[model samples]
Target: MDAIDLASLLCSRLCHDLLSPVGALNNGIELLADEQDPDMRERCMELLSESARASANKLKFFRLAFGAGGGFGDEIDTREARTALEGLYGADKRIDLGWMVTDEKMAKGAVKLLLNLGMIAGDALVRGGRLDVGAEQRDGALEMVIRAEGPRILLDPKLREVIAQGHSGGEVEPRAAGAWLAHSLASQAGGSIQLNDPADEVLLIGVTLPN
Candidate 1:
């Protein structure tokens, strides 16, 4: 697909993901306005706070992964990326993150690729699991590895195709837009993405980019 097409797909994905939390925010507001019981009103306030936090977290993640975040600098602080990932996943407490990147900073493209891969892996944990992310620079290249282990993992075959081959036979779907973007970033950086056998109990994704 062309740039415009890919952009539209990403936008659709973002909207779809945000709709639930945003809608919850709206509903909480309405309920708060109509409720007279102090306990119920306090409950609505809690709901609204959670929904607002969710919305903000998603936006922060999308900005760095899919938009021009971290300013116009060529390199981005790894700490910022960690915070973004934590906000997106830590808030829900469904997945535990173990970060192992020793570098203080990484190129913008590498940061985006890493975050996208993290998101994909975290989502695959259908039964709530552990996600371990590691990165190191060697041989004038930046390498990243993300592993997801859970009771049940359910990664879409199309996403695997996109990450491995940069396209999924035909047009890319909105849900796999992040994978597409990750593939594009890697390819643009003279990098490659590798995935372990899908049949394996754990999901492993590795990416390498020339530095």
Candidate 2:
């Protein structure tokens, strides 16, 4: 990937992840300014604490996956990666994780690719569902598949566009930011994303990474 494109992608990712907790912090401050009750103040403090922790964990995970320390030429720390994934999704027991591949270090690009795919799968499951994430080495390349199965699948059209084209410069009519980011990351990693739109149920995302 070109340096300029890579920089833009990283900036986009940073802005996207930081917005949530930072917005929560702002809301907490506003509540503190208007509320005088002791109990309410305690609740606001708790909100702030939770938001801070969530933001920190996200940054830690992104840093390892997107930063220079982790890359194609370097070995990823599998333990750290698993811990980060758990931090991101383990809080809710709704989504059961099925790992088909061995716990081994992967390329940094592969790590980011898989994480983004997982995020997409999670988004498809609005009412909670099962996510099966697996990786395999095939034909001198690495292939990753994320299967999301739920009673109802919420497929955003804008996200479908991003996954198919790799870029979209328009108003955010829906929650397609995550899909756009996933497309950018996949393009940078010399990979492509394929979605299976079954007529009945389940949304499957397939990503292939060049080794």
- Which pairs of residues collide in model 1? none
Per residue, candidate 1 scores C-alpha lDDT tens digits across 1-211 of 7789889988998999999999999999999989999999999999999999999999998999888775649888999899999998999898999999989998888999999999999999988999999999889888899999999999999999888888746777898999999999999999999999999999999988887
Candidate closest to the true structure, highest TM-score: 1
lDDT of 1: 0.91
lDDT of 2: 0.72
Mark the 10 consecutive residues where model 1 has the least summed lDDT: 163-172
Error of model 2, residue 133, in angstroms: 1.3
> To one decimal, what is the Cα RMSD in angstroms of model 1 from the true structure?
1.1
Residue 204: error of model 2 in Å?
1.1
Candidate 1 regions with alpha-carbon error over 4 angstroms: 70-72
> Hey, what RMSD does candidate 2 come out at?
3.9
